[model samples]
Target: MQLRLQQRLQERRQQSLYRQRLTLSSPQGAEVQIGTERLLCFCSNDYLGLANHPQVITSLQENAARYGVGSGASHLVVGHSGPHQELEEALAEFTGRPRALLFSSGYMANIGIMAALLKRGDAVFEDRLNHASLLDGGLLSGARLQRFRHNDTDHLKQLLQQRADVEGKLVATDGVFSMDGDSAPLGELATVCAEQGALLVVDDAHGFGVLGANGAGSLEQAGLSAREVPVLMGTLGKALGTGGAFVAGDEDLIEGLIQFARSYIYTTAIPPALVAATLVSLELLTTEAWRRPHLQQLIARFRAGAEQLGLPLMDSQSPIQPLLVGDADAALRLSEKLRSDGVLVSAIRPPTVHAGTARLRITLSAAHNEDQVDRLLDALQRHA
Candidate 1:
């Protein structure tokens, strides 16, 4: 067994598919430190740059003094702290939902939502390019899972029509695709789901705290109400620069998740300090509206620069920009070149994406200034 495992690991390395982690000694920001080297970081999900904000850090510190570092138990037990409730309420109001429930992570929230809502005879239609968590949730639901082409509502509609015999139908998609950085055809998908009487689930982990005028996320951007999209999931660790995740919906859905979602029922609640820090970050997400526009500008600058340089850029309007390198080894080489140039961009390889579609996943953050973007462009030009 050990020999087989070793062979499989070696195969991954030979295919350039082995993954590694970097130890960050500094807080998450546009510039991060690894040991003594400060690299221009363009691979973080901190779109709005609230992760290292002074106010967010202060809130965490103060709340830790008040509530301690760990949540003592699960939310159903006694771990549902004041800050947890407060953050839930804030998120509900922000998303214009009747209620919201928190989870330890986006994966748990996605899994819990599917498990709570789906049954053995039900059907789940998902986008082919949906996040791994959403895909896993569909599989775990004991439902007949059908995957449609990326952002193709017609394909989803056809799948829904074919699955008409199922007891229940749920359609799930990522509001903003993480790797591709393109948005789902949310309005069209909602229309199809409505026509088919299928409940729509949207994971806006990459969109929340970044899109919309009020930073309410992709639903707001698409003019979708709670009625249009039933289950809305968002993570606090991305643009909010905090930790944990939440699902917002009408009262009944929240109540059902509370009752039937085993992932939520069995897991320890997220820390009060983290939740408190998220509250601060949430506040900043809404009130400080300039962050979104600044981020858009940065994305535009990067895209335009990449275009001029004739980089193999994907069609993405969001902060995530992929430079398609096709081969895993080539993508790794490009990433290493940028790293050697004091820039941090990760190479995303299969099976995170399809084979032969390996690319450099360069992410932008509002914490980054125009000059930093220029520096990234310069490095890409030199290395790519």
Candidate 2:
């Protein structure tokens, strides 16, 4: 069996499908040291560049000195501390939600939300291009999971009509799609879900720190209220530069999740220090309006340059900008070409993306200036 596994791995390598990590010797920022080359990295999910922000780092250090290290227990077993509680309140208010509950990660939060609200007879309608985590949550809930055409509201309504007899029908989507870098048709989806008596769940993992007034996320951008999109799940990992996620909803949903969500109740609580860092990140994400505005400018600049170079950019204004490279081998070659020119935009290939749509994911952050964006464009232009 071991030999067969090794042979299969070799076959992947031959097919240009083997994946490996690029080691970074420094903190995550616009510029990073990959091996000996200092490249302008454009592949991080850190949109607001809070991952290495000085204030957030200071808050973590100060809180860790006071709180020691780990929580040492699950939240339900007396590990929930003042910092965690404070952060939850802050999250709820920031999201315009009545209550919120924290879990260890976005993956866990989705699983917990679905499993707690849905049972064997329940049904879930989801976008075909939603994050894999959401799909896993539906699968784990033992619900009848149905996939609608990507961002196609008509298909969603058709599925909901088909499953009208189900005890529970929840429609879920990603605010900003992970690989494709497009947003869901939120307003249309919300209307359909509302009339069909299906609850809407929006996972704003990539949108939380980058969109709307004061960066309140996709729901805010679309002007949707809690009553319209009932369950909102957003992460602190991408823009907040922390580890954990929260599900924001009304009092009843939050209370029920606390009682029944196994992922929230059974997992060890995140460290108080990490929560502190996240709180500081949230402050920056909310109050500092320039970060979001500056990132938008950078995105526009990059898009304009990519178009002039005839690159296959996606139809998105968010930080995630993907250039479709078609073949896995072609995507890898383009990434290598960029690396050679001291730019690091990662190639995302099959399995992570759909087959035949492997791409170069070029992410923009506030930590990057216009010069860096120009430098990346120059590198791509040179290759083109």
Candidate 3:
């Protein structure tokens, strides 16, 4: 068994499908010292650049000093602290929902919502390109999972129509497609779900701190409401530059999750200090409109430059911009060339992306300036 497992892993490496980690010598920012090289990177999801903000770090330190580390138990136990409660309330308000529930990670939150709200006889519809966690949750829910074409609401509607004979239906999608770097057709999707009498779950992982007037997320960006879209899941990791994730909806939805979401109920809670840090990040993410606009400027700068160069850029208004290089080897080669040029952008290959559509997943951040964007463009132009 061990030999077979090792052989299969080696097959991944042979195909350039293996992923490796790089150690950062400092906090996430525009540039980082990876080993000995100070590479200008365009791969971090720290959209507003609050990962290293003084206020967030100071809050974490102060809270940790008072509360110490690990949450020590689950929220159902004695571990649910004041900071967690306050952050949850703030996030609920930010999302324009009646209530919100936090989980250790986006994956856990996705799993919890799907498993709690769905069951064997119900129908679950998902966008094919949704985050792996959402797909996993759909599968685990035993909800007769049927995936539509990426962002194809018509296809989703057709599937839901077919499944009208079933018990109930839940239609889930990533508000921002993870690898493709595109937005789901939320306006159409919301209407489809409403007409079909199905619940819509929007995982706004990539939109939480970058989209909408107040940076609420893609739901708000689409002018949708809790009554319209229902279940909303967003992460603190990407734009908020913190850890953990949450699901927000009505009071009933939250209370239902509390009673039945296995992922939330059984697991140990995340650290209280991390929650404190996230609270600070939430404040900055909400109040500092400049960071969001600056990030938009960076995205515009990067995209316009890439377009002028005729690079294969995807249709994305968000920070995640991918250049779809057809083969895994080609994507890896392009990434290596960029890295050698002292610019860092990760080569995204299957199964992170679809097998044939390997690419460089270039994520912009507020930490980067126009010059850095130009530097990346220069490298890409040469290699592309």
Candidate 4:
């Protein structure tokens, strides 16, 4: 086992597909400290820039003092605290759902939802470029997992028609593609699901707290409701600038998950302090309407600048703007060059993305200013 693992590691290095973690010595923000170097970062998902907000920190601290740090047990046990309940209620209200159930992470929430709702004879259809967690969930659910073309409603319709006899049908998609930053054709998917009697599940991890008039996520931005897209999952670690995830839906769904979702039943609940901080973050996410527009401005500025530099930019209106470099080695080289130029951008490679589509996944944040966006553009210009 050791020799085989070592060989695979060496092969990954040779192929320039090896992954490494960078040590950060400071809080998440537009600028990050890596060791002694302070870099202008463009790879964080803190879109609304509340991760390090003073009020959020204070909430965490105060909650910790009151409720302690760990949840101590699973939600079904003696673990779920006041902060957890409050956050779930707030999230349900924010998403306009009947109820919401919390999970340790988005991955867990996806896994639990699929496993609880699906079985050996059921069918799970997903977008080709859906997140790894969603794919894993389908596989684990013992269902017939079929992946349609990415964001192609026609392909999804054909698949649904082919599987028309299947009694339990669930269509799942990422509200926004994480790597490409493109939104799913949600309205079309919802319509198809409604017509076909299939349940539509949308994992809006990247869209929540970043899209919609009140930061209610992709469903809201696309004018979808709980009736249109029944199962809605979102993460607090991204735009809300906190940790954990939740699935919001009608009361029946939440009750069913509580009874059947193994991930939720087995694992310790998320930290109450974190949940407390997230509640504050949610308030800010909706009230501070300026953050979204400013983020859009930055995205536009970066896209325009990248276009002028002849960089390969993908079609993304979200904060995630990836510049496709095509080759893993080239992407890594460009990322290194940017690091050398005092900018921090990460190289995303297979199998996170498809082969030959390796790129620099540049994420913008509301914490960034016009000057910071220009700095990234300048670095890209120099490297391009």
Candidate 5:
């Protein structure tokens, strides 16, 4: 087994698909310290730039002092605290849902939702480019998982038609595609779900706190209501700049999940102090409307610059801007070159993306100034 594992690892290295973690010596922001070097970072999911916000930090510290670090047990046991309950109430109100249940992470939320809602002979339709967690959830649910073309609602409609005979039908997709940085056709998908009598599940992990007028998420941005897209999941670790995730829906749905979702039932609840921080972040996400526009400005600047450089850029309006490099080795080389030029961006290779679509996953944050964006552009132009 060890020899086989070694051979597989060697194969990955040879194929330029081996992954590595950068040790950050400083807090997450537009600029980060890795070892002795400080690089202008364009690879974090801190879209609203609240990860290191002073207010958020203060809230966390104060709540930690009160809550005493850990929750001590699962939510059913003793973990659920005042902050957790308040956060859930806030999330439910923000998303315009009857109730919201928190989970330890986005993965656990997806898995628990699917496990509780789906079962044998059920049909779960997904987008080809859906996140790994959603796909894994469908598989673990013992459902017939069918993936249609990415963002192709017509194909999804056709699949739903074919599966019309299947009584238990659920359609799952990412509100925003993580790798490609494009949004799902929520309006069209909702229409298809309505016609097919399927439940629409949207994992807005990337879109929450980044899109919409009030930063409610992609559903709101796309003019979708709770009736149109029932199961809504969002994470605090992304645009909210904290940790944990939640699922929002009607009272019955949430009540059912509370009783049957094993992941939520068995796992320890997220730290109450972190939830306090998230509450502060959530307030900022809504009240500080300037952050989203500034992020858009930076995204537009980056996109325009990348386009002028004749780089292979995806059609993305979000902070996540991927530049297709085609080959894993070339992507890795480009990332290395950018790092050497005092820039930090991640090279996304196969398994994370399609085989020939390896690229640099450039993420922008509101914490970045225009000059910082220019620095990234200069680095890319110099290395390209």
Candidate 6:
């Protein structure tokens, strides 16, 4: 077994697909400390930049003193506290849903939702570019999983037509493709689901707390209601700059998951103090209106500058920007060069993206100023 594992590891390294982690010695922000180097960061998912907000930190500290550190038990056990219930209510109200049920993380939320709702004979349809968690959820649900071409509504329509005899049909998609940074055509997918008598589930981990007028996510931005998109899964760790995730829908859906979702039933709840911090972060998410527009402006500025530099840019209106580089080694080289220039961007290689579509997954945060964006562009111009 050791020999086999070593061979597989060697293969990954030879292909330039080995994964590594960066050690951050400072809090999350536009700039972060690694070792003795201070890097202008562009790979964090803290889009609204509330992760290190003073109010958020104070709320966490206060709540930690009040509730202590750990949840101690699962939500179905004695662990669900005042903050948990309050945050659920606030999230439901924010998403305009009948109820919201929290999960320990976005991956668990997606997995539990699929397992609770699907069984044998049910058919699950997913976009080819949906997040790995969503795809894994469908695969693990004991249902027939079908992946349609990425964002191709026509292909999805045909797949649904072919599987018309299946009574329980589910369509899952990422509200925002994580690697490519392109948004799912939510409006189109919702319409397709309605026509095909299938349920639509959106994992809006990247879109929530960043898009929309009230930061209610891609659904609100697309003018979609809870009825149109039945299952909405979002993460607090991203734009909300907290932790955990939730599924917002009608009361029946939340109740069903509570009763049947094993992941939710068995796993310990997130810390009540963290939830308290999240509540404060959620308020700041909607109230601090400047964050969203400032983030959008940064995205626009980066894209325009990249275009002028003849960079290989993808069509993404969100904060995630990908500069496509065909070879994995080339992508890594570009990332290393940017790091040497005092900027931090992640090289997204195969498995995260396609074989020939390796890219630098550059993310923008509202905490960043115009100068920081220019600094990133300057580094890219020198290295990319």
User: What CA RMSD would you report for each candidate?
Assistant: 0.8, 1.2, 0.9, 0.7, 0.7, 0.7
- Candidate 1, residues 49-164, lDDT tens digits: the string is 99999999999999999999999999999999899999999999999998999999999999999999999999999999999999999999999899999999888888998987
lDDT tens digits by residue: candidate 2, 1-384: 999999999988987889998899999999999778898899999899999999999999999999978998999998999999999999999999999888999999999999889999899988999899899999999998999999999989988998888868999999999898899989999999988999999999999978898788999999999999999999998988878999999999999889998999999999999999999999987677789899999999999989988988989999999988899999999999988888898989878888899999989999999999999899888874
Off by over 4 Å in 6: none
In candidate 2, list every pair of residues with a backbone clash.
none
Higher lDDT: candidate 2 or 4?
4
Writing each residue's lDDT as its tens digit, candidate 4 over 19-58 gives 9999999999999999999999999989899999999999
Off by over 4 Å in 3: none
TM-score of 5: 0.99
Candidate 3, residue 274: Cα displacement in angstroms equals 1.1
lDDT of each: 0.94, 0.92, 0.91, 0.94, 0.94, 0.95
User: How well is each residue in 239-333 modelled by candidate 3, as lDDT tens digits?
Assistant: 98889999998988999999999999998887999999999999987577799899899899989899899998989999999999989999999
Candidate 5: list runs displaced more than 4 Å.
none
**Candidate 1 vs candidate 2, lDDT winner:** 1
lDDT of 3 at 233: 96
TM-score of each: 0.99, 0.98, 0.99, 0.99, 0.99, 0.99
**What is the number of backbone collisions in each predicted candidate, taken in the order shown?**
0, 0, 0, 0, 0, 0
Question: Local error of candidate 4 at 277, Å?
Answer: 0.5
Q: Least lDDT summed over 10 consecutive residues: which range in candidate 4? A: 280-289
